[model samples]
Target: MAKITYIENGGTEHHVDVPTGLSVMDGARRFTIPGIDGDCGGACACATCHVYVEGGWAERLPPMEEIEHDMLDFAFDVKENSRLSCQIKIDDGLDGLIVRTPPRQY
Candidate 1:
């Protein structure tokens, strides 16, 4: 399992263990971590799973595919670090991943 930290807009933090092969969105959903709506249920269709990867973890993540890039366009407060949590597959290498949710989804 990989450990992931999720931060809400007001700075609330949730630490979760994400099993390998599941996505970060899965971890948030499993723990009912507030802020990640995951409207599309990990289909990579909606950007409600949007998050900003921080603490240098962004570089460790795989480059976003064109589909994910286009999807993020619909997210709130998109940033260079913005990523759909569903697009980030949790693995041992991502043990200490950290990300922050935006103030709102829309």
Candidate 2:
């Protein structure tokens, strides 16, 4: 399992043990972590799972695909580190990964 830190809008942090090979969105959903609505599930059709991947952890993630990029365009408060949690597959190497939920998921 990987240790994932999810920061909510009020700056509250929820640390979860995420199983390897599952998407961050799935992990969040499994733990009922707020802020990751995952409105379209893991279909890559919604940006509700948007989160800002911190610089150090960002580099460790897989490159975003065109579809993910397109979806991010619709997210609120998008930043250089913006990513869809559903697009980020967790792994053992990603232990201690930190991601901040956007102010608005829609």
Best by TM-score: 1
All candidates: TM-score = 0.97, 0.96
lDDT of 2 by residue, 8-92 (tens): 9889999999999999999999999999999999999989999999748888788999999999989999998999999999889
Q: How many backbone clashes does candidate 2 have?
A: 0
TM-score of 2: 0.96
Clashing pairs in 2: none
* Candidate 1 per-residue C-alpha lDDT over 12-95 given as tens digits, one digit per residue, 9 for 90 to 100: 988888899999999999999999999889999989999999999999999999999999889988998999999999889999
